[model samples]
Target: MAKDKLRKVGEVAPEFHLYEADGAKVSLSDLLGENRYVLLYFTSTEEKSRCDRSGCPLKENLEKLIELDVTPVLIDVDPVEEHKRFKHDHNIKFLMLSDPAMETIKGYGVYEKVNIHGIEKEKIVSTAFLINPEGRIVHVWEPKKIEDSIDDIINAVKKLKGM
Candidate 1:
């Protein structure tokens, strides 16, 4: 499989407006206006095994992220209701935005065409981006392992704060 081109550090992050689980609209510019940094996590809730392995740890560490003044946002290709239920089931505290059209996913350059269970589908590759208040991407992590991504994100947040 070919790797998708991703936004790199120092590039101005793409702006997007997506709906949260509660149907409230969230704009990237709005987040940047309020927070010093935004941690955008692109993931899926459809695959339970993968979601549990990757999403759970991030859910558990919400407080740490908050303390660092980084707003963590979860983006999924699922519908709003599905995202709502997923958050409820997992007790996730952060905002989980739904991008059913996958426009934001594609705009972020995380969308990939992959074969799953003998079926070809376009899915958002699990990725994390740290965008500074100036709307510049400060860190990008395309993890080979979900477990490692959590630590990478935390370290990236710390490093960004230190800078």
Candidate 2:
């Protein structure tokens, strides 16, 4: 956990390639220098209530983000089969990448071992990052709680765009 503190704002984001739910490879460089803001949300199994609650807000706010010209990327740390079902169930049209080994998840510092319901411990953190066109992190929401609203992300994007 502490070993993987997220890359700080103003630092060039680390680049890596991960397979999307649709089987396409997506790399950080793909978004860099694209002249568009990139919004990345690292998610869980999506079947879990925590994952659902964490992801629902982003889905609900997709239209507004699209309106703002922000490209939303969803990273699923669950298995491929689960990710497929989750994608179909949620009808998520945005980029959904799969990181089964959690290599990318740990790389981004969103992977953590936490106990949910006081029963089992697992990676339960939900995080989002707003990266500017220059590849530097402009804003970040590490371990974003389900109670947080999409407005938080939208406002941050709006603010970053003005910079």
- Shift of residue 54 alpha carbon in model 2, Å: 9.5
Candidate 2 global lDDT: 0.71
Task: Candidate 1: give the clashing pairs.
Answer: none
Error of 1 at 7 (Å): 1.4
lDDT to native, each model:
0.79, 0.71
Predicted candidate 2 versus true structure: per-residue lDDT over 57-160, tens digit per residue: 66677798887778888776666566677778867677777787777777777766767778755473677778888788888776445337467778877876
Candidate 2 Cα misplacement greater than 4 A, ranges: 46-55, 114-124, 143-149
Candidate 2 at 55: error in angstroms? 7.9
Q: Pick the TM-score winner.
A: 1
What are the TM-scores, per candidate, against the unseen true structure?
Answer: 0.86, 0.80
lDDT of 2 at 129: 78
Residue 26 displacement in candidate 1 (angstroms): 0.4
